[model samples]
Target: MPYTVTIGREREMAEVRALLERRGDRLISLVGPGGIGKSRLAIEIAHASADLFPDGRYFLPLEGVFEPGLLLPTIAYVLGIRDNGEAALEERIARALAGRRVLLVLDNFEQIVEAAPLLVRLFDVAPEATFLVTSRTVLRIRGERVYEVDALPVPDEAARGGERAMRSAAVALFVDRAQAVKPGFALTDENAAAVADICRALDGMPLAIELAAAKMRVLTPQAIAQRLEQSLPLLTAAARDVPERHRTMRAAIEWSVSLLPDEQRALLEDLGVFARQFSLEAVEALGAGRAWDGQALDGIAALVDGSLVKQTEIGGRPVLSLLAVVREYALGRLREHGEAGRMRAAHAGHYSALVARVAPGLRGAGQGDAVVELGMELPNLRAAVRHLVHIGRLDDAGDFAWRLLVYWWIAGFFGEVRVWMLELLGKDQPITPHTRAVAWFFALWSELWQRPTEEVVAGLGECVRLFGESGDRDAAAMATAARATARLQLPLPDLATAERELAEAVEELHELGNAWAEAITEVSRGRLAWLHGRTDDAQARFDRATEVAEASGDLFTLSVAGNHQARLQLVRGEVDAAEAGCVRTLLVSIRLHFEEGIAYGLEGLCAVAAARGDGERAGMLAAAADAIRQRVGVFDAEAFTVHTPQLDAMREAAPAAVAAGERRGAELTVAEAIAIALPDEERDRIAPALAQW
Candidate 1:
């Protein structure tokens, strides 16, 4: 299940399940207003009746589908049916589900209601297929069964007078969720009326009640109830044309938000610029040099207390987030106050600073924590980029995207970042030379080994020139190294030219005192030397790169050089040394959360195992690497090409055992993969150290 249902949606779940399970009711729709729990209820029903479908219960999210024509293709994608453009998509879908009892759950279908009629045709062609949908509006198609999901039941005024009110489904859910945040919360005589009143004020909407209950950690139920009376009505009067249910939801959010002091309110609105989880430090950066002071921490606490913000723990550190509903409301308030632009600027600036801060840490001892922390912030980083782009801050957007080039490559977000970069570049706006240079560099990195060699070469040329013009000697050298690497990858390889370029890049980086970039350039030189059959020279470069990176505390560069060094040792039959280096590199990769590093490290171990005739272990490790690569959206083609001989040898030696090992590896999660790659003693020793950051 991708999402969890609310505690009190049980009855609604049962009813929805009955509709979905009922024969001939192929198009059953869960209908409700925004924040009325329709999607959660539908998901619950789909999950509960998973076995009843037998073939598969495919959930297709249509929120991102803006064009109605893309609807069928999206469904085909979820069904794993590729469209060859030769046949009608509907026909292909019907043929695929011909004899299978598949359940197609089209979620957020309201956004693409124009495509609703297509479902009728689908049902007509495939009687065994069932369509389970969630939408705010009814499909209005023939035989469509609409299960109108409503707000959770709230106690009447009379029921609010006694203990019976505490048992109301809405009140029960509120208490349950509240206890999750603040344990010992209950419907005692001292707070029972307050709880009941709060639930009723929000009209028993599940999202509203949950948001309100989250406040119980700090505010008394009576205070919450009283605050709601003020904020909800103010918005209701201002937005009369909106649907009553939506207005109520907005009111509930506004009421909670209104309880915050001025500093807290400003912080909440500013934080709303984020579309995903953010760190405390990131929020503080937003408040830096502002009127927001030491009280900013108190502001965050207040927002969390009011349930306008949600707090979560990642890697033992607290992360804060806002629910989509609450975020939308906050954004509305932010825009209304004319603070949207300034706050978004702050958001982008903070993430840019974050990228620069973490970029250095990506190489050293605490690299794992740095990776985890940066990975956690990726969503917010992306959100900041999108916000900047949305507001026509193309220069800022490009700069923001450029700062994440290393991160996107390491974290396997190149495809996503590439899309963002292309969109930004496509915009009809003037771009500053520095931002353009950064954008081009990002494009070059993303297109590495993925794009045509000529395109990659051109992008690198432009990137290097722009970086030089921008007076960033370190960045220019990095770009020079990339161009040299690309030059060797060209159709007619230029080994001489690549060596010349690599030498110049190293010199430039060293002169600029950018040890990190210099180490990176050195690693490239090492790889080039190895390719040219200069094994001893390659080893020296790798060793030098490792030393520089270690001194600079740059884990990414060290991992690169270390992995290559381990491969060298393996080829030279230094089995113990190779294995030890691989383990250490794997640990660094895991800590840094660098997927490519982890994959390459695993592959290095695979090579060692294959060389030692340990085909089974080789296969398992290869499978683990493959899984990590697939998850991270990366493919280290160079590593694959280099290891083909070894992997083939292992497969040929023990084909069946290799197959079983691969299966075992496929089942391993990232943590499990780490555990399998490292010995028990090594893992135990690293465990406490890994958590330190």
Candidate 2:
């Protein structure tokens, strides 16, 4: 259709084809961002489906026509319906194609989107005709089925090898374009990674890939990729054959932005502060003091309609995002208007307050929902923290990081927070002692399992002093409990000291009415009791921990205590009770999206399977647990030692089956592994949430 073959759009083509086959979908709109190959895909679909329309397949190129009134006349001209002063143009066109099963392909309708209603009217008059439209925006008329044309799939890091990289649609397109520009150019082992990098950096947009590949006439793929940091300037094409707007990625985006109303355009520029997806609440907060404060929602809808912003749901709440290229363009507009600094400060302030407000909820009854909310906003949260730190607001950054301590720990974001805290602690500027103490605690806790237990205990001892001196007795007691937990992990653990400190910490937490911290302290005590071979005492402590966690509605602590009880159940040879306990804990962990808790639940299930002589199932669950542990950067030597003996016996009995199951499990995602570990009924109950994840 465009002198080049289409690449990597088979799924889209099939989906659009299916829609077209449906009689109700008379008006099908292929909508996406500029350079996403919408026009090309529409032409290919129309050409391929020529047989479906018995009359004819007509193509009308509307890129040059910008006026709304010219649209009807243009369609009339394309259909060869000359205006002869007899009837109206629409009537004549409808009469000419009334009974004909024709297909009309309208290209570039975004500039004249106001005329969209005319297409519906035309469709009403000519019942047998189907209109296939390619636009940067949706038409929003009746009977219009929008098919979003996404960018081609690019190779991820794992698939960046020679032949593996070529499997990507984006890479294949780039190779085809490169060979056209420079004959015999192939994807070799040496240059494959560079090509993959270029494709990914360009976000897999077709026009951008073609433009970059055209540079193969002189520059290497590596050189082109290196220059892509300033991609807006580097992605221009010098070919006179290409349209002026299509010659550069920037011009293509500008053409779309030029068609927007002033309010929507301004809102888009202001929204450049978000580094990732943002919620409507976030949009409202960021717009609070701006001139368009009350019009943000309407403006966002308009931007979404105009294809400048992408809208999706996370946790059943709508979230908006911009493509990397579009965001870059919006950010450039923001800088040109000199509002980048002000907007970025507002964004950071909003997210900082957001995390602070949700921090308490993460520790109590709202733990599950709060964790999901924070997880949904994590990218924005990270961006906010980085911006705060960048603008010399170390105190605010550290405070925000500390407030989200529970969320960070649950979502496996502690490593990232550890880096931010390290940067904050390294700064020469002064911060509040409370912030300093929390920052040190985060830095130490993130590496508690990776680093030596002695070092963690020593660092946490300082945190305890800082929190106490800063008048935060709750934090001080929490740190005291953490120090004791670390001591219990040491080679020759000071059991007596750990027992004394835990007892003191629990009493302090209880007096302070901090049930969440008290629950955690009890779990530590339960672990201590179990180590001492005091089965009755251990069961009592775990039961108390569970009771406190349930009272406080702390899912994290509940999962912890539940897993501990499950381990005791297995020790007592109560297989059924142990399995039930592990499944219950897994449901709680999945609800909270707590990777560590999920891994522990899997480990408990693995032990149950081993006890039942299901070697394959045990090995599968164990490998899955290990995968989560590796991803979360957590290792529990004590727990590993407890399970090691049974796991070894299972492996020894059925080595091949265990090895095969381990390989299969290692390849599963967290969600897939959860499916394997859960019973069908429980999985069905959690399907909706897991699907969102």
Candidate 3:
């Protein structure tokens, strides 16, 4: 048996055993695509069916064999049958198993499929011997029962829940492999969806999943999911024991592609234009002007049969997509052939037009459906933006960014959009003044919580001036509110200027009927009020912000206001109310995938714990907040300063408890931290499994 634990093959194992037990089924072949665990499953079946072959069991790997004539010699070598110059190799091997119940396992027979006919000669000589073979292609000889091995079962939407995700075979295998590299790694609520996404993105192939999980030694599951856009280079193995072909995902995929015909190979590379799933009509559009001789349907069927392109159904229509690893390999071929630029342009143009049609629904009554629709197409959308920016289509890129603003904000993709905007602005090309201003505003908005130096404040001021001159009153007002907030955070706070600008911006936004902008500006007003020590005024501002956010369906802003209000509650000695508010905010933030909001929620809960004199809990929550802040590369110096006194007091009162708590919390995932922060009754009711961690 292999050293690594085998995951989830109960059905295949039972079927293989039943076939082997049948009177005529003496030779059983396990067939599947490369890296689909055909070899691993064969080993498992052989180990489990040991009792039937009590005389002898032998394993031979034929991966290095290239000529058909060398098959008998290789088998005789493995069985330790020497050429004594008296009998032929095959006759000697047959004599060794003539009258005994023996089992022979042949691994990696695809490299020498021509030698498959030799298996019948040995079976004819030995009456009671059973042969088990693993190959990517089926051996269509007599008495050979083929067992098709598929990829592990991946988690779907319903199985994305923390506990249900763990039960999925793909996710379980990833966790098991990840633990082999980083022993402390575990699947938790915070990373369950990302882990499931990783499994699905790899198409649940065992070798690919193992290659991805090995990255846990340096990257988080969320980070791995994000980096999978170019997964080939990131998913490589350094272990010396594994075979060379299995050491990298690309190597394994390339081996399979090497076996395809020239025309089918070209079709596979051409299909790389699609970033994700595509219908038959979509693929036909890609082949419209190409010089391929065969039909697109025929080529797709060949690739599907070869396991290079997977065919699935969505909404009663068949769709096709390449596994992330295979797609990356195909894309490399596209780039090598100099067709990537042309194909990428067509892909970008199609998605850009599609987003234009869907932009309006993002803010209308069909917002929920729109969000789900856009989420499913996020990869294609991202690819389009990158292509546009790369080709210096600045105006189009800016238009696309602005059109998807609401979706980006709601889906917690502010950082990604910020990078795209910065890249677009970096190109020294002419763009509309309004486009430039909007780009600058978004690029600066993502870093609003960082220490606002003079340079940052100056940039925001420029955005405000350009927005006003461009005749966009709503944008101008939003920029003004942002500039005010940054000005207040300066080394020497400009209270007079901040207060005046915020009032004007809020009044203008409200008059313009922009509920989302109004609500966000109101939160800034509350922060200013808090600085002025007018606690009642601050509470009223936050209440108004929350009310407007709820009415406008802005959960991100609602979480922001809730966390601020919870901080005030802690200051008022209302620990229970503060704790409840923090829990509510955390739940909303988790749903939105808003990391910054989650960090704030943790900080607020830390204050509540400190007020209750639970120093350990307070220290743990504070450390977890720090971890999130560090990962996202965001820091609020002012907020950290405000919490310093409470943290210092906890440390001074119970140094040992605080230190131990910090150690434990530094190891917690967001889900684990939330588990500890939840109220006792609720934590026990909802996440009893995580309590121990």
| Clashing residue pairs for model 1 | 363-554, 363-555, 363-556, 364-554, 364-555, 368-591, 368-592
Candidate 3 total steric clashes = 0
Q: Candidate 3's residue-wise lDDT over 1-693, tens digit each?
A: 444689898888888888877747888888876678887887787788778887667887665444565576556545544322112445666665666687889887876888888898788987888988988779889878888788899999777677999888999999998887789888989999999988877778787787677667667899877766454434434324444334445644654465467777887887787765776666666675665444788888767655567777754557787754467678879999999998888777777877887876654344555676786666577777878887778888887887887776666455556657877888889998888987987777645645567777789899889889989888889889989998888879888899999999999999998777788889999989998999899999999998987887667778888988888877777778878888888866665556677778888888777776788888898889877664443343346333456778888998888788888887788788877877777666556334432
How do these models rank on TM-score, best leading?
1, 2, 3
Of candidate 2, the 10-residue stretch with the lowest lDDT total is 80-89
Per-residue lDDT value at 13 in model 1: 74
The residue pairs that clash in candidate 2, if any, are none
Clashing pairs in 3: none
Q: Report the lDDT tens digits of candidate 2 across residue range 510-605.
A: 999989889989999999998899988998898899899999899999998998988888888888998998999999988876667788889888
lDDT of each: 0.75, 0.79, 0.75
Model 1 worst lDDT run, 10 consecutive residues: 80-89
Clashes of 1: 7
Per model, state how many residue pairs clash. 7, 0, 0
* Candidate 1 local lDDT, 42-111, one digit each (tens): 6777778877897778888665454566577567545644332212456766766777788888987887
Q: Which structure is stronger by TM-score: 1 or 2?
A: 1
Quick one: best lDDT, which candidate? 2
